[model samples]
Target: MKVKGVRLYGKDDIRLEEFELPEIKDDEILVKVMSDSICMSTWKMVKQGANHKRVPADVADHPVIIGHEFAGDIVKVGKKWQDQFKPGQKFAQQPAIPGQAESPGYSYTQCGGAATYCIFPNDIIEAGCLWTYEGDSYFESSVAEPMCCVICGYKTNYHTKDRYEHVMGTKKGGSIAILGGCGPMGLGAVSYALATDNKPAKVVVTDVDDAKLARANEVISVEEAKEKGVELIYINTADMKDPAEELKALSVDGKGFDDVFVYVPIKSVAELGNQILGYDGCMNLFAGPTDPNFSAEINLYDCHYNSTRILGSTGGSIDDMKEAINRAAKKEIKPSVMITHVGGINSIVDTTMNLPDIPGGKKLTYLQFDMPMTAIADLRNLADEDPFFNELADICDRHNGLWSAEAEQALFAHYGVK
Candidate 1:
């Protein structure tokens, strides 16, 4: 089978092309991708090139397919899988299928999200990371996989530095302060925080953009919270020289929030998260800055004196994806708002190559895998119909076409994305 996808040849070089997919073995299940979200990690690879230690060295050498966050439907299952799995069911899948590696932990690399179809092993199928659901839309299922990554945060015990554990709990009372709340991952974190039993008492969101802050508030419902709900607040960071100081002042009666989640990559945000810690506060470092050389000054004294605890989380655990599936089904949260751009699979080359200029939020580049050749060029129209597309266009126009590769570099040089 031929699958259309976006591949990265090197830094600042991406190509959308087709590749031959291996025939499915009796133990493999092939999934037709419905929707795939552009992840920051993918964006990092696009800008920095694949020279990192975590990724498989050969993956970067080959025409590597780009994408890690996605949702899809089971189009065909092997004869062995048919007995346990059904066709036409919606599922949120983690794409990494481990090959010859010394250990599973280091060996298993998730699937590339930006493809028409993906194949998963039979053993992983039964583990339930690839969730099967009834009466769900493909677009919504796409959100589940990303949400699962957010779920891993709730299940994480950062203080112990122990393996992640997803234990269910009540959704009442605890407050969640989401730093860098305007970005897509922060927004997704907000969704997971809202849908869970440990729903924060007050959901405070902080961002540099008033527009994004306003956008976050607009998506939250006041009426829906008639029975039991969390209070939502969006704060802009542009005004504050010290976000930590501002956070301290905003705390209830000058007491800081219960949980402060740092989604921004800057070192200052991580340092400030510690300063504003309330008694037994949980500070979660959600975003992983691409530059490993980046480091920040921290006041360890605050951590010891204040009894503040900090934890770091990344990507989705299988259990987190399962929870994301249930939450997506409930419509309690929708990440669609985070999608600021939509282009076809072919456009992905230009789309990813221009990540820095995109300015905070998700960009969904469309791919016409199933459509005929005629559909490839015309597919932008379908994307234009989405509200987020309008937002992308407006942003692009506002920034003087900075969303393009050449333009973004100039824009980033001004803002120092390099």
Candidate 2:
């Protein structure tokens, strides 16, 4: 079989190529990718070029396959795998395969999911580590892996078995704010908050970009709060000289929001969210510093005196992915809303190289491999074949509507999507 995918061979360079499939070993199953989402991590890889940690040094000399967020079908089972596994099942899998040689404290593994076909060990199958969702499309199902990473991040920060368990105020009317709210992770926090059963008194989202803030409001349906008699404010954190003061101003009544979710890498939001936290307020850091060397200055005196708690989370865990999948299945949460662009695998390079120019923060873009033109006419057509796609397309359409179709086309064109 020929597998199609995006590969990086040098700095700031990615190519979509097809390759012959390798012989599958016993106890391994081969999956044909249904769809894959371009991610910030992949963006970082292309931006950094050859310096990315995840890009194997060996593959750096060759075209290394690069993608991790995706879902697919079990098309081929090895001789040993066939006895235990069946084909034609939907599965969302992790790409963190252990390398052949153990390096220092880390186990060596060659793993990735960007290719059209890849193999998974029987352990992953028997353990149910590969998620099986009956209702999710392959494209939408791929998001479960990303959701698992979010769950992992949630677990890292809070001690709760489930982060959704903590309802700030009422089941549907709690108070929350997301700082640097115009990014993907920020967008994820927003989705989680809205999808949670706990209601908020208000959900105030802020961003430096008026355009992005506008879109955030639409995607989350924050405006619907007005009809429901709930308070939701979409503000611009653009003018505030400092993140701390800016957030402090947002939290009226001398107490900050019941919950503050920081999406961008603004170090000050962490401190400020703590400073203005309500009596039992919880400020969560859904975003971290971009540079590993960066650290935020903390005033220990105030941090200890106030009952404020500051927490941070990253990538979802298996449990979190299950929860996210279930939530998505019920339409309680839709991850597709984050998708902003759609293109073929050939467009991956340009897309990652110029991500900022692309509109819609936390947008999910597709690299439709070998798909025909009739199926790829527009966002609406692109999403129609998939379940979660319509919701995601609706979110994109809402923002695309704010601008002229020509303008949206130009933006997509800049990323070589057209």
Candidate 3:
């Protein structure tokens, strides 16, 4: 079978090309991809290429498809898994296989989300990483992986009343602060924080940009959170003289934040998260940095005498993805708020390669068509040029300028799905 996909050759080498795929074995399954959200980690891997841990050393000779967070429909089911899975079922998958070198996206040539059709290996199916989605839209399932990462912070965080034992998960009804919480993952944290059953009494989100903070508040309004029995606040620490103190003042009794989640992989942000730690506070360094030697000066005094502690978490387990799917399906959470741009598979190369330069939340790519990368905010600007953008803009406006299942359905209709 001939399929189109973006492939990586070496350091900073990637291309969109049509390649021949051999017939799937009896144990393999075939899927037609619908949606994929580009990640900063994907760009990092593009820069490192063969040098990347998950990528093969001989990628120059044998290229691998590039994309991980993806969702699509099953096209063919092999005899080995006919009883377990069948064709035409909506599905999404977790890319990370514990202690395994070759998982989809980074290491597979025929089983990555960037392609129109990819094979699902027997191993991936058996690992329970592949999940049949029952959500309203494919984009939401594609976004589940990143949302899982954001939700993991809350689930992985721990607080302790005693020095002897640790209390797992975020402190219930306690004050929580998301430091640098205006980016994609940051906004996701805000949503999950408010939506979860174990809601925090006070949720404070801090960012450096006025526009970003405004957008965060607009997507997740303070009024909406109040209805959920939580006080949601947004702060722009761009010019604040004492940002840490100002942030701490927002907490109950001016004590400090019980849980501080650092979303930016920056030294100052990590330090600020440390400074705002309340008594018995837990700081979760959630962002992954490109630099291996990334370090921040923490408050040792608080760590020892004040019973404060710090930890880091990355990549949500399968359970986290399941929680994200259920929440999105139930309308309890809107992970789509993290998406700011959309495109087709043809745009995957430049979009993924230049992700850092791109200013947006999630850059979602639908694999079924060919379209230039367009931002949701820029849709109105292009309304006069193309009626497609005009219609898309109208659809988004109906949903508060956010992506929805309706918007996705419109895209499928507009692009004439493969």
> In order, what lDDT does every prediction score?
0.60, 0.57, 0.89
Q: What lDDT would candidate 1 get against the real structure? A: 0.60
Best by lDDT: 3
State in Å the error of residue 414, model 2: 24
lDDT of 1 by residue, 45-133 (tens): 66655463334556545555667566566778888778767787766665433332211111122245677776776666755556677
Report residue 290 deviation for candidate 3 (angstroms). Answer: 1.1
Q: State the lDDT at 343 in candidate 1.
A: 45
lDDT of 2 by residue, 70-137 (tens): 66677777786565557887776554433322110011122345565666656555555665567534
Compose the digit string of candidate 3's lDDT tens values, residues 27-119: 999999999999998999999988889998889999998899999999898898899888889998988776687878999878898999999
State in Å the error of residue 4, model 1: 2.2
* TM-score winner, 1 or 2: 1
Clashes of each: 18, 31, 0
lDDT of 2 at 40: 73
Tell me how far the alpha carbon of residue 69 in candidate 3 is from the true structure, in angstroms, after superposition.
0.5
